[model samples]
Target: MLAAHGFVEAVEQLASGLGVSVLVLSLLLIPVATELPEKVNSLLWARRGKDTLAVGNLSGALVFQGSLLPALGLWLTPWRPSRDVVYAVILTLIATTWLRLANRSGGVRPVWLLVNAACYAAYFYLLTLR
Candidate 1:
């Protein structure tokens, strides 16, 4: 995911130079950019018999994005996120809540996957409208 994020950052930089709007760049770049490392890491971790690390990387992105990244960004500047960002943040929170609720009841169910897919759809839709 970290490596994927770097690619997104590169796209954002190039897009900015082309006078592309942030919203459009974000919408276009995020899906492709975020998935590459996630998929690779998951596959490699599974191959190495380190399923825990693979899962951790998946969940850790949420925590890192929700808490660490923005907090640090806030410290650097008086940051005020745009409305699309707010939507994205809300989507993440909702997804995390669903995951947490699932975990509390024992093992995960099929609904968790459905809910996650819905969340992704929502985010993608929101991005497209931007």
Candidate 2:
């Protein structure tokens, strides 16, 4: 907990130095940092043709983060949904639905997975427009 606090403080300082809002800095950096390990593991597993394990690893992390963290935040904070939050939720639904449909219709192609990256890029673009 203490280390996390220190890391957050360092990120805030870096954000200030870069003239970036802490929220923006965190939105850009935090998820990538937190999800990196899962992503790397998934990639390695996929490279080894352990497709199910790779997908399971990534899906498990997503499920935990997507559900539990948001539930905890909602329970612990007087959180109000902002425009960005709404946009994010909408994009998440869209991406998830797209993936599900694609998987149902056929196997998910590499090109189809690019849509997820596009969704992330779209979120960043939306942030820049704000």
Candidate 1 displacement at residue 69 in angstroms:
3.0
Per-residue CA lDDT of candidate 1, range 9-89, in tens? 888788789786666576546745655688688889989999999888878875776579768988999778887778778
Error of 1 at 5 (Å): 12
Give the per-residue lDDT of model 2 (tens digit) for 1-130: 9989998998999999998767768777888988999999999999999999999999999999889997998999999978777777888888999999999976899989999889988987887786
lDDT of each: 0.78, 0.88
Q: Which stretches of candidate 2 lie over 4 Å from their true place?
A: 41-59
- Whole-model lDDT, candidate 2? 0.88
